[model samples]
Target: MTQLADQRPIAAAQEAAVDPAVNSSSTTTSAAELEQLRRARPRGPHRRSPLAQVGVRLALALVAVVALAPVAFLVSLSVRSTDDVLTGSWLPGGFGELAWGNWSAAFRTIPLAHMLANSWLVALGSALVTAVVAVPGAYVTARAGKRGARLSAALLAGYCAPPVVAVLPLFFLLKEVGLTNSVVGLALVNGLANAPVAVWLLDSFVRRVPVELEEAAWLDGLSVAGGLRRIVLPLIAPGLVAALLVCTFLAYGEFLFAVSFAQTTASQPLTVGLSLFQGDRTVQFGQQAAAALVGVVPVYVLAVVAQRWLVGGLSQGALK
Candidate 1:
């Protein structure tokens, strides 16, 4: 009896030692499995690297720096004195040395008021004239293709024509007609030069207008011209504004032939007035930059105003 009881206790102990859970706790995995588990365990959070992220951010910073450089230089030059501008580098170590006399004398050297009026007259006049001529031409061309479209395209070509090509002939023609160098003469020239583009713009726009509106108007005994003036013109006023803005900007910045056509400050535009600052020896970069910035204001204003029309006009043509 004593021997049997001791044997039973030993057998129970051996069975507990051979259990799967006890074996797994100490060393379940084989040598190869243990090696793989040790290798697979992550050493750190940076499994790869953030180099690509750093590179993208760096590239964006470079672009921003490049873009801001010119604008910053321009502003800096504008505020600095002429001596600082001429003697000092493009960058000034100090801000106090800037010469502000150019801005102060800008009005005196030229009849700035008169020049502004001339610029407005040329730009606004050309834009208005272009809208008038182009709108009808574009409408007809877009509504009636092939023949009318060709005619419209031919006119658009004139806008693309070199100013030099037109300048001599236009001058001679105007002189022969006794209209040379006059405000009226310049206005007419600007108007004629910009009209073709207007026609082309209006042509495509008119096609987007629903035919039902025109048919109803025609049934009411309104002639095509009358309908265009009343219904079509009103509907496309946004596009007209956009066209006016584009032509005005072109006319305002025009250089090549405007200089040739204009003679004195009495009739000369701002563009010409600004050019007088570039002396034979010293170019007043500060004053030039300031003046250029001043000119840019009107363009910015016109662009903002015109953009309001663009969205609605585009939506009407596209979404509808």
Candidate 2:
């Protein structure tokens, strides 16, 4: 009986140890499952539902199609014959007969080379010259005393004055001196008309440059002009680009003044060249379309090139 009792305790101890391992294993498995559940739970922000995702994708596709439609039309129209256009056909009846001769018709009708050259001279001259005069004027306006504010306000008021109202006086003034038909005279008018706009834009831009920067340059033995040339010029480049683009585009697209002033095809800008096709006999739609396109291409190219500078120039002045 003593031996059996001793054996019973030993057996009990062994069983207790085995039972603990089983219980611990079960607990550990449960804990692991709980941890996985916590990890798999959704985070704080709302989830993108399936419906919302599908709707977003559909909206993007629709917008893309809409945007691409015009480009598709232009490309198609440029190649199509008059019959294809008149019939409202989507594609030319024949695919291989795409006529590129319309572009030649456009060139011949509009005096494209002469207009292009004139437009380039006027646009480039106005932009570069405007930048030269406007930058200094803007710097002065920004740095001027309280008296300068009154002057600037007056100038801004004049800028808002109607160009139509000023045109009569301008026409007479140029006509009086026999400058009405002159390229230099036209450039002067363009520059003057555009200067006020440049002044306002550059004034705002100049105000944003930190005063401390100039002072540091001054302390380093640089003159005011030197400091401005080195520091201010580089920083204000975007504004200059933006301002130049605006001036050039306005000058290039100017029809009223060019119509009134330019008598000879030699002096006429691109804007007026397109109108010469309207003879009493007939209207050349193909030529008209071509000329319209030629006039637009240069302006489009100008805007595209200056787009980055324009964004920067417009924004920088606003914040400061």
For model 1, residues 1-320, the per-residue Cα lDDT tens digits are 99999899788767768886765655745766899998999766455358866877899999979956766777777777677776768776665665666575666555766877788888887776777667777787877768987888787776787778888888888788876766556767787787776676666667767778988999999999988889898877766766666678778887665677777667677788779778999777667777766676666677667777756654554442
Please give me the total number of clashing residue pairs in predicted model 2.
Answer: 0
lDDT of 2 by residue, 1-320 (tens): 99999899889778867799876877899999999999899865356678877888999999979966755665566666666677767776676777677778778776888787887777777776777778887888888856655666777789777777777888899898887776766777787778877887777778778879999989999999887789888888787777777788888887777777778888888778877766787545445556666666656675677778887777876776
lDDT of 2: 0.77
TM-score per model over all chains:
0.71, 0.68
TM-score, structure 2 vs. true: 0.68
Q: What does the lDDT read for residue 122 in candidate 1?
A: 81
Model 1, residue 317: displacement in angstroms?
A: 5.4
Cα-lDDT of candidate 1: 0.73
lDDT of every predicted structure (CA atoms): 0.73, 0.77
Candidate 1, position 290, lDDT = 73
Candidate 2's C-alpha runs over 4 A off are 1-101, 145-154, 175-179, 215-227, 280-282
